[model samples]
Target: MNLMETIHLHKNDFSKTERKVYDYIVQNPTAIETATITKIAELCQVSTSGILRFCQVLGYKGYKDFRFDMLHYLHQEHVEVNSENLFDELTSKYLSVIRQFNNIDQNKLNQLIKQIKNTKNIYVIGVHYSSLPAKHLVLGLQDLGINTYFAYDYMQASHLYNTIHEDDLLIYFSIEGNQNNVSRFFDLTNASKNTYMITLNPKPKLLIENTLILPGYTLSKQSIVDLQSIVVIFVELLLNMFHNTLKED
Candidate 1:
């Protein structure tokens, strides 16, 4: 089990001091990535020994080992599985997903922007409900004067993928991330080809190396609507950020 899972499974067994430390760790996982044991102890209002015992209880050798595992856990995307407020849940979900982007490596985003600017051509692809957001992104990119192509179906996308070259880029969107055509496209493209996948699923089936897993509400049939509602905002951010960066250059 991961650190979060371990915490959840055994939190009730914790002593008062340990519970304080565990709660702080759960709420501020990102902070722990750079935090010293002394600093964490201060934040949790506990002694350093208390923190060490907490780590031991969680099956780690020491605080450093626990901190390392927590840092690694933060790398994987997470999604909320429950919501109490139905009326505002869509907005809440989008806000949570967008917050995840704050932790994204700025260098990685800059590299993608540079690749997009340097590409010979750009193609956007998505399957089923994912196509809606993909189309929205293509239109926004086109509005910014980027030459963008989009393929809405498997046959059309296969034909377009054939023409893709080294300098070309493919930006794919998928809520589920396991579309048959998407898998095929990955097979056809060279490892050197520029590709980015923006997925709404936390535990996507595709599991490609180049993927951004965004959190989204997937509780029921209306979940697709939830995704569509907020993806445009993200697409707008990407297009405008690229446009502004180009002008600065």
Candidate 2:
């Protein structure tokens, strides 16, 4: 279930302080994407420990866990796919996008592959539909015995920033490339050089240096296109390529 549903089910059992946290969260859902626990506590006029108790009351380990789930819930609020007889249209779009995949910047992809091969740890990040590719990459990396962590984004006090080394890699999977959120993510790493972004946006803003632009159709409001499916195919093929290249002798 989504975060709001979980909150609703447990709201009645919340303490007075917890209700304050909930009210602020519902009023500013997107702010939680990058808000720290301390910031939230101040905004809700509650103690930091109060926020922790609120998260625990909602069955989360803590505020970090709650924020991650909250971001997932926010991203879920999008237009659903329609099952119309636009098979021909969708097929044509898919073909067009697939052909564009052939034009992927090999130089950048090679650099990305090298980074993945050399890094001891990898953090795969994405929000909304882009999470599909992030998750696919995470599982594929694990099959190759690589250490991978899948997260919507970095959180305060999360290990993503604390244990990240210079040799580590941070690969972002974003469909449109959220500039502000992604820029902050990069800043959190102290402007790490071992960063890469795989995105469909032709002109993504605040993109990392190693970004590789891939072919994709942006899902528009009420559109009958399934662009994410094409990205999945591309990521799967990319993973297969990685498997072939990085597997042990």
Top of the candidates by TM-score: 1
Candidate 1 Cα misplacement greater than 4 A, ranges: 1-85, 179-191, 217-226
- What value does the lDDT take at residue 73 in candidate 1? 73
lDDT of 1 by residue, 1-249 (tens): 676888889989899999999888776665564457887797789999999999999888999898777766766535554666554755654455454454444565677788778887999987677778889888888887889999878778878877777778888777666645565554533335378877755556665567665434333224535366545566777777798888898
For each candidate in turn, the TM-score is: 0.64, 0.58
Model 2's C-alpha root-mean-square deviation from the true structure amounts to 17.7
- The lDDT of each candidate is 0.70, 0.70
TM-score of 1: 0.64
Q: For each candidate, C-alpha RMSD in Å? A: 6.9, 17.7
lDDT of 2 by residue, 57-146 (tens): 988889888887876675566633477746765565456456556457778887788778878888887666777778888898898889
Off by over 4 Å in 2: 1-85, 153-159, 183-190, 218-226, 247-249
